[model samples]
Target: MNEFTLTADFGMTASDNGFIQYGIHPGDTIMFKKAEDFPVNGSIVAVIIDDGPITLKRISFYGDSLDCYLEGGSSRVAPIFISHAEYGRLKVLGVAVSVIHSLAPAEE
Candidate 1:
């Protein structure tokens, strides 16, 4: 099985960044496998669009937009909006089956 880690922050590191990536925080880890097929609604998927960084989110297909909910995210975290017109750029890399929160103390 192949695995992917956040070897590079890509300058997007933040508290909510981790929440959107998995659950806990940055430095935390998760295990996933290829999505194989387009994920259905409510499925946690690792996806990317328009050559952007990969992300983990629960997918929901809307009429002209793709609503993606971040797993274990706070109410303040906004859902990522992707227009159907950009669907061609959507790439589902894998399904996150498990998460491992970083045990290190979080900094304020």
Candidate 2:
């Protein structure tokens, strides 16, 4: 079985970066399983860009690249496109399995 970690900080990290949509709040707890393979299309992933802090994004594979979106589903947020060459610096920490939303209302 893949190991997973529950962290409220992970939610807060994403929230702090304006990933407050998709029901993931600053104080919410999240369960993330360690990535074993490249995620298929439309997987919610935790990625670290060029040694930067981790961020949660929905990734969709393109021909030789990928697009990362802050919010998934009906939201209209623009995606951040990553080219093939940049893949070397991108680290996929894991895939998100579920979220436990915070009781407190989110701050706008």
Identify the candidate with maximal lDDT: 2
| lDDT (Cα, tens digit) per residue for candidate 2, span 24-82 | 66666666777788777777788887799887788877754454333343356566666
* Total backbone collisions for each predicted model: 0, 0
* Superposed model 2: Cα runs more than 4 Å off: 1-14, 63-78, 106-108
lDDT tens readout by residue for model 1, 9-93:
1222234553653354665565666766767777767678668887656776665445443343445646766665556777877
lDDT of 2 at 2: 100
Candidate 1 stretches with Cα past 4 Å from truth are 1-23, 63-78, 83-85, 106-108
- Candidate 1 global lDDT: 0.60
Give TM per candidate: 0.57, 0.64
